[model samples]
Target chain A: MAYNDKVLEHYEKPRNVGSMDKNDLHVGTGMVGAPACGDVMKLQIRVNDAGVIDDAKFKTFGCGSAIASSSLVTEWIKGKTIDQALSIKNKDIAEELALPPVKIHCSVLAEDAIRSAVDDYRKKQKGGVNASGS
Target chain B: MNRVDVCWSCRGGVVAGEGFCPTCRVIQPPDPRRDHFHYFGLNPGFDLDLGVLDTVYRQRQQQFHPDLFVSRGATERRYSMEHVTRLNEGYRTLKDPLTRGEYLLKVTGFREQTPENATPSDPAFLLEIMEWRETLEEVDLKGKNAAMQLQQLRDRMMETCDAEVVTLGKGFHDWFVGGKREGLAVAAQHTDRLRYFTRFLDELDRKSELFF
Candidate 1:
């Protein structure tokens, strides 16, 4: 299937494609995969103490859809509150990326990655690495 | 249809006291009596013996390979080709444990791929997946040792996957023999793990290819 223009654009030049310090309590990282197609996606966010996302980055290994999905989400999550980032859904990513039915799982993987990264950030906050254990 | 053991010649007498008709010296048609497991010369069990399966598959392919009949008439060649095709399909289905379980379920008229049936029951597995992904992202940014560390991590993940496969085999046996409902759930869990392992391996492969 022909890719959406936006998806093709992001895939060609993915934004914020790097990782921050794992030891940084403010950074949350997530990795996910779709078993059916053997795709892997990694997403990370740097959140301030106030839970406002300051930065986002991603890396994906799969088809164009997967690359676009991660790229789009990384763009979406930055500057948003943790709550807003958590609400991002696979359908939105799929629609935005114009992913075909077979590639919907790629969007799901992206959503999963976002949730995972947020959860990791929360865990680190609770564990007293970056933030004092509340 | 004539029973495969009976000979048409000698008034349906057993030829060579086995498969041949003694009176006409005619060889009987190949037996269609074998089930999928028996056709591959395996015990009728859910647990697969992959070594034996591979050996039998190779042997069967060698024996009935279409190339062997290429010089023969079109009819014989077509028959051989069909046999080879079926053999390959059957081998593929039986080789993978999840596919094998599904095939058995289909054969037994209990074919079901419901979401509940295919989903993993353990919530911890999902949590584990999340943590692993976090570690992967951490390593992705590390320039020099990133590829090497990813390979080592992937090797460990594959070892875990191999163990899961073995556990899946046990679950299959339990399901087939004990009619345990949980066997299906276990099978589904293993299927998920297998997919994750495959994805991780593919990632490592991509990184290695780019570096080298």
Candidate 2:
């Protein structure tokens, strides 16, 4: 299937493609996978004291749509508040990337990753001692 | 794909797997309702005897061979083709452990549990999958020991995949034979793992081609 130019762009030169110290309290890691297609994505965000996402990173192993979805989210989430990031829907991502109907799930996976990362961050904030990597 | 009980030619009541209409002697269309197991006259369960499946497949293939229906009416010929097609599909699905497990899940109404984005609920499992992918990323394909490194990784992934298959079989057995509903969930998880492992293996194979 032919990918849109935007998807190909993010896929070929994914931005902020890396990892953060999961042990860091400021870092929230979101790991998600697609069982039907065997695609895995790890999206992370570093939130500042004011609850603003200052940095985001991701590593995805799958098709171009999946890679592009995660890559696009990392770029979009930076500087946004956690609440703003939470409001980011998969449909928006799919539209931004011009994802096909079949690949909409890739965007959903990205959305799930971001939500999980935010949830992890919130859990850490609520339970400082009992957070992950403790 | 409905279960056709009456012969299209003579409209005679046809029993399941009766092959020819009792009155018209025309080949009946395969019952769409009959699942892969039922297609082979086997009980709907996880554990299956390959030898029995093979024998039954061959026997049915001969009994419903499309060539035998060439002189029959258009409906009979179409029915022969449909029967052969379903038979081939059933055989393929039942012959493999993974596909068979998947088919059983579909037949048993657990299909929704493994949708397109049905990732495992456990973070640790995703973490392990991420580590495996990261390992593949870390390996320098152009390095002198790249082939060996890739080989080792492939072997380890294969072993893990095999273990997952074993777990899947046990899970299916518990659900289909031992009457445990929770076994379906376990089987679903392993099925997801198998799907991931299969794709991972395919990726590894593609990368290994770089060595050539």
Maximum-TM-score candidate:
2
lDDT of 2: 0.88
Q: Score residue B70 of candidate 2 by CA lDDT.
A: 84
| Candidate 1 displacement at residue A103 in angstroms | 1.0
**On residues B11-103, what C-alpha lDDT tens digit does candidate 2 reach at each position?**
778886567888978777676667778778888876788999999989988987889888878988888888888889999998877778788
Give native contacts recovered, as a fraction, per prediction.
0.17, 0.88
Candidate whose lDDT is highest = 2
Interface RMS deviation of candidate 1? 5.7
Model 2 spans > 4 angstroms off: A129-134, B1-4, B10-13, B22-25, B210-212
- Alpha carbon lDDT at A94, candidate 1: 89
In model 1, residue pairs whose N, Cα or C atoms come closer than 3 Å (at least 3 residues apart or on different chains), thus clashing, are B15-B20, B15-B22
